[model samples]
Target: MEYARRFPGGARAADLLLCLAITAPLLLPDHDGFAPTGLPLGWMRIAAAPLLALAVLISRRRPVAAAAVPAALGLAASPELHTAVGFAVAQVTLAFLLGHRAADRPPALWLFAGVLGAGGLALLAAPDADFEDGGTLVANVLLVFVLPWLAGQGMRQRAELDRAGWQLAERLERERHLVVHQARLRERARIATDMHDSLGHDLALIAVRAGGLKVAADTSPQGREAAEELRRSAAAAARRLHEVIQVLREGDETAPLRPAGESVAVLVHNAKASGIPVTLDDLLSDGDALPPMTERAIFRVVQEALTNAAKHAEGAPITVTMSRDGRNAVVTVTNDAPAVGTTPPVPPQNANGHGLIGLDERVRQAGGTLHAHPTAKGFTVTAHLPLSAGAPATPPRAASTTREHAATTRRTARRRALHTIGLPTAGITVLLLFMALNDHGTDSSLLEKHKYNELRIGESQQVVEDRLPARQLRPEHRPARPNGADECRYYGTDPDSFTPAYQLCFTAGRLSHKDKVVLSRVG
Candidate 1:
């Protein structure tokens, strides 16, 4: 079924074949018996039947127009010819096709109803017709036209329901994929937070402990120098580890750095204390007035730029600038080229080379932009952070909100399934029960009392009529020679039933033979 939906031309071709099947019967020689006779235009009217059948065949593409062709042709053909079974069948098929194939229902239904009214009037006025009475004609029209129209309507509703179900399933599938992807992202964020909080703190403590060991007086002079080198290296390694952890915590709820509003002057002072030749141009004297998130982003940006400059451009003079431009806080860090004989420091093993990438994400989360590139003399890093209070401090969706949205989507899908599937199933069940109760068959009580062995030979016809109603007898299974002196058979079972049935044969109005027979079941 999914494959067929992908290529709908195959289904349209099948519908075309069905239209041909319904129309081909009207073009046969049997339909010519009802053709007009003893008139100069009789042959033309006979030809119109085939032409109308051809029009019905063309209606598969244009249902509304095709439906009108047969109806108009039928009304123009002859009032006497309306009694023909082929004529009635053609109109019924056209009515069903109109409702089944029309893109819109209101117009199709109105057109069909108009055609039915015209055809019913013609059928009633038909000369010497089987349905001449007003009540009989109305009943006939209801059976032949209205019932088939209702069936077509049901088919249209079912098709619409199937399409809606397919669309809903597709939407739900996409939502499921989105929810799963969000969950994976949240898990990664959680892991990043844990690593930064535990591992980062431990690395900082290690650097502090190594610095204390270097200044202790109990150590020898050579050991003191070695401890000093260890302390310097450990401090460098700790700074590199912090950059890596910051990158890992890009999309996490909590910032990897201290959430307190740290001063940019303090960040610059620390870099100069680390033996780097640096200069600061502070434009915001009172930096504590800025939002905590904006200040944190600015501090991290300057810290990373200074660290990179110290490692890659040793002995280079660096400049740091901070200012407020309209609604934004702009920070730029630039360093001069290293001396000709200078060599860059070796990067630590723990570095993942994602420091700048993580910094960009952090700046973006704070509604800011960061740019880092090499100049003719040295490298420069610049960041612009929005000072607006409305700037978002995190990603669009949090873990809690994503889970709630997924749950809501699931509940909506369940409700849609119940309305679309459950309601239709219940309606069909009720219709089947109504049909069973109203079916033209022998009552259960009659079948229980009249088993095959109970009827004896030579019983009068009047005697059997007392036990079973005449309407319960199967006409097709009746005796072949009822007017002859030969035995006449009357089967006692429902016409549509497959159970073991009883047959009573009468000759000269008296029961002559009785037997049990198994009826053939229709598929």
Candidate 2:
């Protein structure tokens, strides 16, 4: 029921409600007024209605079980059942649901095969009814049970294929959009990077020229003062340029946080110079022991963490800790609480979206993990990069492996179907053969009409023995004599049933009496 909720609409609840409502009428007398077979109509319907409802209840998650419940009960009850229309109806619905709702094919396929074998077993086991032959029973079972289930399975496969096709289309569409988006972001980052590097170098050169002018021997006091102001203004413009660049390159994963050759210690020192009260704790077997990618990832993690601290927990005492644990290089950047209340800073919308996303990407590419969360005091960012796991394992070839997996699944399903069908059918066949061979009746004992007419009243025992056939009958199949006699022998006109047989009595080695031919009980 819960899984069916994924199907859509308020009708999910209505399905069960309607099922139960229909079931409510099972408590009322069957309007057809047919004689109750064994249990009353209400009680008989009760046996199966709730089960079908339960089958519907669990059809989504346990489709195979839903199919099995009615199949098993119906097969077991087939012998006593003069008509299986009720069980057949339930079975057909459940079978279709089995196929339609099944998430996988093998289970339902095997179940269908098993139900078939169970039906065969029921054939051999059910007591023979004169009105119903084995052929008709088999036909009914296949039509109302197996065929409908198979139809449902067909629909299931078609629906699954349709779903798969749509999903593939959706994924392709998403991939196309992602590729376009990433291309645009890359082009923007390249522009941003070029602007930052070229413009930043020009501003630095201008600051240097102003400083030279400010300190030159030929320069006057007013001139030096003007040069000094110019230098400060140029420096401020450079800082503003950097801030603009940070926002411009917001989601750029490839964009560098700082210039190359700067170590984590240098970054910490720079943060300290910025007056953020930063501290560094480096405890490692060797500082430069990590691989290049992992080292780069570690740098980005610390860079992102420090940036967050500055933005969100400004003025907090920040601690940058580096250590080696097991095969992982652990780097943690945690900031103490801000001077404000324990409440963490609400990050600017733009800032919250990108920096940490880049950090996560960087860490994962290096075959590691990144975690950033707030603590009671403030916020923390931690990264664990493997020291010697090498690069992440190469992804398997999905196209080729998919085909191989499909082939393997098909093979397995075929094997299971054979086992499911073969075992029970074989058992039933052997038992049936055993029953046929063990039967003890023959035509030799049968009394034909001509033989019965050949008999004479008070015929000599020798003549009667010569005319008599050698059929044997069970005591229960023999007819009751009107008058008691010393010995009576029953003979069948046909070797199968007991009716239409002859009974002969003999006394003193002579035929004393001959009973008239009569219909008798079957053997």
Candidate 3:
């Protein structure tokens, strides 16, 4: 009903091309007559062109349903046009396009089955049609119809897979972009939260301590004046921090507010007191205290490493080393393997696997490099911090595409191209080879005038056969047998099977009758 939708310009063009192909076999001079079942040749030919054209137009939208049109038309022309090479060409072209155009895979396969069934039925319906033997019948069906349909189906699958691959790639890229954006937001939030809890608390405590010293009675007048200024400056710094942060709280709503600005030594001592075998090897007694950023970086590295060790390597001794290497301060925290027969509970912080991501961001913001990897016997996390304030860098963005992904795509495309082209090419080559090696349908030298004149009606059957050609006329080109002949064999007078043929009949092991039969109309 939707004429506009069903027959667009492109569909019209394809219909024109298909109609042209359908009429091609009829136009040949060798095919002078039409075979119509229960209908005139003119009527069926006029009806079939438009009907088959309609089927071709709808093949893309409805493959299985469109296939029935060709089947009905083929049966209508059976034993005559159905036997022509052009008829097979048109029908097989429809079958191949049906497979290539159908979107659903099951229905494409069904169309193949439908055409194959129709081809077999067409053979049975046209029992008088010429065929060399059983093998030729089956081979023709497979070669002309089944093989082309299968080739189309293979091409369709390859195209669909290629589209699916592109869709998957696009989806993964979307997910990657979203994940990267969310990670950046989460890491920045954690950094702000961490600074407020630890560094802000330290500033507030220093302001409180300066106020106490300024009011103490044992303090000298000059020391009191200096302490007053120190308290005022510390108070101003705390106010500025509060103004920027706008909200401050412990790491968790219920987590106890531990003393702020605890040195790395204090962190190691606390871990030791908590039943973790921890040792601190401090070799920085002679150097000036590290920059605030550097010191904070070191504290977080040790704290996170110790927490991980307690959670993963329970009861294992940990060594926290702080040594100066060149202008950078190096901190290494290593924990031995966990105790045997002990399994640690999985941690929930990095459930999304962003724990180390956050840690790496924290160290990078403090102008430091962090490395955490498996050791020979345990896990080790090392941080290298520049003692002087260096320009901080954000974590590098993840690559949007990789060489491996590109390589995989190229390989898939190459494989699809091969399947789309190679299958049909290989099938056609084998079909050609099979027909070449197995085709022995008609003998041109059988019914020569001289040979035909020498044959006698009362001759012995074996002697007649010996004198005649071994190859006989194909069934379709053979004419009706004369009555009372036990067996009839037709032979082509010329190389072309459609020319006039000689008919020989044998009865009771003796030649009984002979006649001239006209199998085709000469154009």
Model 1, residue 61: what's the lDDT?
Answer: 75
* lDDT, residue 174, model 2: 69
Query: What does candidate 1's lDDT look like per residue over 35-146, in tens digits?
Result: 3321323454466556665665577677777666655654565433343334556667767766666657777667656755765676566665555444444554455556
lDDT of 1 at 226: 84
lDDT of 2 by residue, 1-523 (tens): 3235544565467567646653553444221212323345444566778777887677667878977876766555553332322565566677776666666778866775776666565556545543354565566657755677778778777767856966676677667556545644543453455457767888999999999999999999999999999999989999998887777664634455557568788888998998979999998536557776677678778877887888877788999999998888999999988786655567777523567655665676668887889899878899888887477822221233334555576679769989999899999989976753333343455677677788886787888988776544545545565464667877766545555667788877777777655654544
Clashes of 3: 1
* Segments in model 2 whose C-alpha atoms lie over 4 Å from true places: 1-3, 6-43, 58-62, 72-84, 103-132, 158-181, 187-219, 228-523
Q: After superposition, how far is residue 94 of candidate 3 from its true place, in Å?
A: 7.1
Q: Whole-model Cα lDDT per candidate?
A: 0.63, 0.68, 0.69
* Total clashing pairs for each candidate: 0, 2, 1
Q: Which residue runs of candidate 1 sit more than 4 Å off their true CA positions?
A: 1-12, 27-61, 76-85, 103-105, 120-137, 216-523
What tens-digit string does per-residue lDDT give for candidate 3 at 1-523? 2222345575566567667886665554222222244345556666776777687677767766666576556546542224442356666776677667765667656554655565556656655645543345456556655677777788778867866887788788878767755655555555665566666788889988999998999999999999999989988987787665544332343332234647788888888888999999998646987776677778778888998899889888899999999988999999999889989868756433555665676678777788899998999999888878665664564554644675687779769979997899899989976753333234323456777899988999999988776566555535666777789977767644546777789988999998877866421
RMSD of 2: 17.2
Error of 3 at 24 (Å): 16
The count of backbone overlaps in candidate 1 is 0
